[model samples]
Target: MIHETERTAAAYAAVLTTCGDRASAKALARALVERQLAACVQMLPIDSIYTWDGKIEEAAEILLICKIKRADYEAVEKAIRALHAYATPEIVMLPIAQGFGPYLAWIDSVTR
Candidate 1:
């Protein structure tokens, strides 16, 4: 059980990652949710332009936004590294400051 004042101690987190295609995104999303490392994963088609290997590059990718318990962050990252095709898959974690009470509870309940 979580204490009232300590809600932040068991806070929610949003993970950002990009995959080269939808297939990989789908597989990664399924694995995280199935393993209970994340409550939900939202995949979006996006166009990204950035520098890689000292050169500018542009590509289309699937962005995976995962809502999960902060406690499960490490496991989530590890799972991504294992399945991600990119030698350097982006895995960025951000704290969710506040959200609806029930929705936050659902996130905590679904993820370990």
Candidate 2:
């Protein structure tokens, strides 16, 4: 289990964001990995249902799943905001409860 105070550099985070289409999603993914903010970014097609501008809405979106060391989340969020086309992109981070030792180690190695 990861405690809140000790999560800065030692923990892992899975960041979530959505893009309107494939082109934008791919660009964001490349940027995150190239900057060493995330070890991997997986894109998946998803249908989103939400309320915006006081109205109900539904649309197709590309979900970006980014795996990164907890320490690098700030930089990652900044990078995403810079490149994202949406005015308010959904940038959320979730803690990784547990992962394979080798994979977790790889995440730490690739990110600062």
lDDT of 2 at 43: 99
State each candidate's clash count: 0, 0
Give the clashing pairs for model 1.
Answer: none
Models 1 onward score TM values of: 0.91, 0.89
Extract clashing residue pairs from model 2. none
The runs of at least 3 residues in candidate 2 whose Cα sits more than 4 Å from the true structure, single-residue gaps closed, are 1-10
Best by TM-score: 1
| Native-referenced Cα lDDT, model 1 | 0.89
Give all candidates' CA lDDT scores.
0.89, 0.90
Q: Name the lDDT value of residue 41 in candidate 2.
A: 98
Candidate 1 regions with alpha-carbon error over 4 angstroms: 1-10
Name the best candidate (by lDDT).
2
For model 2, what is the C-alpha lDDT against the true structure? 0.90
